[model samples]
Target: MEPTTLRAVMAALRKPETGCPWDLKQDHQSLARYLREEAAEVLEALAALRPGDPATEAHLCEELGDLWLQVAFHAQLAADRGAWDIHDVERAIVQKLVRRHPHVFAEVDVEGADEVLTNWAAIKREEKGQAADHEPRLLDGIPASLSPMDEALEIGRRCAKVGFEWPDLEGVLDKVKEEVGELQAESDPVRVEEEFGDVLFSLMQWARKKGVDPDAALRRQMIRFKGRFASVEDDARAAGGWEQRDLDQMEEAWQAAKRKGKA
Candidate 1:
C-alpha cells in the first residue's frame, strides 16, 4: 500500500466514534511493548534473510511494514494529544540528518568513516549542549532501557573514544580475570553482586574490543543451548523419562547431541 493510504487507514482506526475500541484506548505507554516486539521481529526477519533471495526480500518487506506501523501508530497518538504528527517526525529527522552530515551536505571534508563518526559525535555533543563543558561524561546519553550487555558495550565504546580504555586486549582480559577473582573473594552478597556485574562488564568490553557483538553472541549461544537440550530431551524420552536420568547420563546425552551437530 502507499504511504498516504496507510496513514489514512491508521487515522480511521483512531477515529473517535467509528474507530477500534482497543486502538482508541491505547496510550503511548500501553503501545510501547508492541513497538519493541515489532522492532525485534524486524531484526529476526533480517537475520533469517539469505542474500540474493527474493522470498527473503518479501519477508523483510513485510517485517519492515510492521515496524513502520509502530512508528505511524505512535505518531497518531502524539497527534491526538496535540504534541506532534507524522509530518513533524519526518521533518525533524530530515533536518537532523542534513544538519549532522556536513561532509555530505555542505563544504566540510572528511577522510574516512572514522573521521565522519568523530565529527558526528562532536556535532551531537554541540546539539546536546555538552561541547563546551570542561569535564564531560564519557557515557552520556547511554539509554537506561538497554540491556546490561548492550549498555556495557556502549559505555566501553564511549570511554574508548576518549582514550580511557585499556592499553591492550590483554589488559581488558586481565581486568576480567581480576574482577572474577574479587567476586570469588567476596563474602557479602551485595558486594558479590557488584563484583559479578563488574566481571560481566569487563567481558563485554573485551568482546567489543575484539569486534564481537556481545548481545548477538550470547543470543546465538542460547539458541545452541536450546537445540542441544532438545536433543538431550529427545534421548531421555526415548529411553524412559528425563527424571530417571542421572547427571552422568544427561552429560552423555548432551555430548551425543553435540556430536550430532545439534549445537
Candidate 2:
C-alpha cells in the first residue's frame, strides 16, 4: 500500500458528492465476500511468483496493492463508524509486536525458535481468557464459515497441542481409510455427505501430521483445475467443435491439459 495512492483512494471513497455509489452502498457484511475473494486472488498471485519471473513478480505486486485496498477500505469504514482508525490499527499492531516478542524488545527467556513460538502461544492464550487448565476446546476459536478442510486441520492442530490427538500419521491415515469405507457404504445423500465430511477431516488430520497446509494445497490444485479447464475450452474452440463436445472429448482435452499443467 503506497501511502500517497492509499490516501487518494480513501479520499475518493469519502468524497461526499463524488464518492463511488457502490462503495457508499456497501456495509461490512456485503464487503466481507470481496475481502475474501481479493485475499484468495492475492494468495494465488503470490504462489505464481518465481525467481527471475519479472512479469509474474509485477503481477504479484499489483495484486498485493489490490489486497491492500480491501484492508484500507475496511479500515476507513471502521473509522467512519467510530470503531477504529488505520493509525490505531498500526499502533495496536506495533504495541502487540513489542509486547509479545519480548526476546527482541525486552529480556524474556527464549532459548530457541520453538521456545519463542511456545511463548507467543502462551501469551495469546492468556490474552484470549485465562482457562489454562480447562483447555479451550479444539474447535473453540475457528469460525464456522472457514473452509471445512481448513477448519478440520485447525481443530486437529488445537487438539494436538492439548494431547488429544493421534501419535502419528498412521493413525490419521487409518481414520481416512475408515472414513472412505463409511463413504462407500452410504446410500442416502445425507449419509454420504456426512461420510464425505469425515473423509475430508481425516485427510486434513493426515495433512497436519505431514506439516502440509490443506487449504493452500487445495487452492493450488483448484488454480490448476481452472487453468486446465480454460485451456480445454480453448482447445475445443480451436477445433471448431463447441456444441458437439461431450464428456469424452472434454476428458481427452482435460487429460492433455492436466499433463501440461502438471509439467
Candidate 3:
C-alpha cells in the first residue's frame, strides 16, 4: 500500500471500537523503544547492502517500511490527542527541506560542497536564533542524548566550522596519541574514566579527519570479534567445553579462528 493508505490503516488500528487492543494501548512514551529498535534495524539492513544487490534492496525497503510504521504509529497517537498527524509530519519536513536548501530551491550561489555547508549552517543558526537568543555556543545545538561517539563527531564538526580545529590530520593523530598516553597514565577511577573518554573523542576526531565513520568502524570490528569468538567457542566445545580451557589455549583457538574466519 501507499504511505498515506498505510498511515490511515495505522490510525484505524487505534480506533476505540474495533482497533487492535495492543495498538490502542500504546502511547508515545511506550512506543519510543520500538521506534529506536526499528531505526537500528533499518541501519543494519542498509549496512548489508551491496551495489546492484536486489535482495539487499528488498531487505532495506522492508526495514524502511517498518521505520515508517513507527512514524505512522506516533503520528496516529498525536492525532488521537488532537495535536498533529501524518500529513502534518510530511508538510513540516517538506517546508524544512525547502527552507534549508536555498541553493536547490532558490537563487543562492554555492561554489562547492563546503560553501553549501557553510551557508546551511548560517541559515540554520538564523532560523534557530542562536545569536538573538544569546545562546551562541555552536555545540549547544547538539542533543545531549546522542551517543558519545556521534556527539563528539558533531561537536568536532561544529568547532571546525568556527576555526576551532586542528591544522591537519597529523594534528588530530597527535591529539589521539596524547589522549591515549593520558589515559594510560591516569590511575584514579574518576580520572581514568575522564581520560578514557578523551581518548575516544580524540580518536573520533582522527577518524573524522581520515574520512572514516567511527561508529561504522567500531561496528565492523565488533562483528569480526563476534565471528572469531563464536569460532573459539566451537573449538572449546570440541575440546570438551570452555570450562576446561585456559586463557592461553582459548587465545590460540581465537587466533586460529581469526585466520580461518569461521564463526
lDDT of 2 at 102: 91
Worst 10 residues of 2 by lDDT: 1-10
- Give candidate 2 misplaced runs (Cα > 4 Å): 1-5, 17-26, 81-83, 111-114, 128-131, 134-138, 230-253, 261-263
lDDT of 1 by residue, 85-186 (tens): 999999999999999999999999999987888998889878877745653666666788887777888888888877898989999999999999999999
Candidates' TM-scores?
0.84, 0.80, 0.87
lDDT tens digits, residues 85-136, model 3? 9999999999988998998999888898889888777787788776735756
User: Which candidate model has the greater lDDT, 1 or 2?
Assistant: 1
Task: State how far residue 235 of model 2 sits from its true place (Å).
Answer: 4.6
**Model 1 deviation from native, Cα RMSD in Å:** 3.1
Residue pairs of candidate 1 with colliding backbone atoms: none
Off by over 4 Å in 1: 1-4, 40-63, 129-131, 134-136
lDDT of each: 0.86, 0.82, 0.85
Runs with alpha carbons beyond 4 Å of true place in candidate 3: 1-4, 47-57, 129-135
Worst ten in a row by lDDT for model 3: 132-141
